[model samples]
Target: MLATTRNTLIQLAEIQHQLQTIHEFFNKWQTNPWGFKEEYLSEKVLVRFLKYETESFANREWEAHRKEIDLHIILQGSERIYLEDATKLTEGIYHEKEDYYLLEGPSNHFITLSSAIDQENSLFLWPTEAHKTGVNVTDEAVMVKKMVFKIKY
Candidate 1:
């Protein structure tokens, strides 16, 4: 798993893509609802824009992907995201088409959503990591707008 900012994403030579294309396209998606649903940024990269309210983790299951890297970029609001090693969690039945499985266990590590203020607004989770997201930062609920990039590796 990796944690970095959007601008840093472009500077990393490791990720294969036209950085300008993604940055430009991202700006467009942030402003218009027409670009809301999941869309392909490249042959192996897909982006999904979503908005929802933060909630308690009481009964929610952590999730891990088998075939993609999840990069979550928070556009607005704040929340806490819990992440843990996949091996520490109990096994879960896999859903072939969706490519993910829900895990059961406690998350011992987490990162509160960062923004422009911290220069690290994005979190990356690979197949080796399990995470429970959309968690409230406080007792009060907060609305969040985020973009998730699903990249097959």
Candidate 2:
């Protein structure tokens, strides 16, 4: 997993394609319909935009993809995302259509994201990284608009 900001994107010039795709998505997807849907960025990368109310960690399930890397970003509101090593968690059934495995265990760590500020915290979670997202940052549930870019691994 890696967390970074928009300013650091240029420094990763070696990964030109991926970086550019992310930048384009960041600019183009800020507005439009705020809901659960997929937008193709390229042949190998797609953006899944979601907007919903945050929930408690207990209600969130750990999930990991088998063939894609998830790049998560918050476009509106705030939420916490829990992440941990998928291999360390109890194995669960893999959903082929979704390309993810359900896991059960304690999250090792978490990161909070807020769109009101210019923090622009972007996280990349590889297939080996299991994560439970859309978690509330505080005791009360708040709505959050998030985008997950699915890139080929």
Candidate 3:
């Protein structure tokens, strides 16, 4: 799923960083698994794998990026991702080299991401769109394996 209310330059970001390497991984995820390794697809594209159990909203933190557009692909299990506009959230300390800052606010909008549940199976989050991921979809916690493609813009 994609949210655009936070920033209208989302289209520009996508066009500049076409996400070509990400598509390659999409086709070879099963045949050529990269495991849980951090790989640099190119100078502009990067690959990261994460395995964790979904936790409560309060336990997680909201974050927004300034340099890259995040493409979250769920490989196994399910998670609820909450999104909020950065303009409305209170900003915390930012990691300069990392290009991200913590956000604190309420988010009433979200989507459930899972291999079996979502038809798209992937989600795109651009700059200024604060997101709190790894959220539990139900009452119980479930382990999720996800691949994140950081498309620099």
lDDT of each: 0.79, 0.81, 0.84
Please give, for residues 23-69, the per-residue lDDT of candidate 3 as tens digits: 76668777876565788878888888889999999999999998888
Write candidate 2's Cα lDDT for 20-59 as tens digits. Answer: 8878767754655444488787877888878899999999
Instruction: Rank the models by TM-score, top first.
Output: 3, 2, 1
Better of 1 and 2 by lDDT: 2
| Each prediction's TM-score versus the true structure | 0.81, 0.82, 0.87
* Predicted structure with the largest TM-score when compared to the true one: 3
lDDT of model number 3: 0.84
Worst 10 residues of 3 by lDDT: 1-10
Mind sharing the TM-score for model 2? 0.82
Backbone clash total, candidate 2: 0
Clashing pairs in 1: none
In order, how many clashes per candidate? Answer: 0, 0, 0
| Model 2 CA deviation exceeding 4 Å by range | 1-15, 30-36
The TM-score, computed over Cα atoms with residue i paired to residue i, of candidate 3 is 0.87
Which prediction has the highest lDDT against the true structure? 3
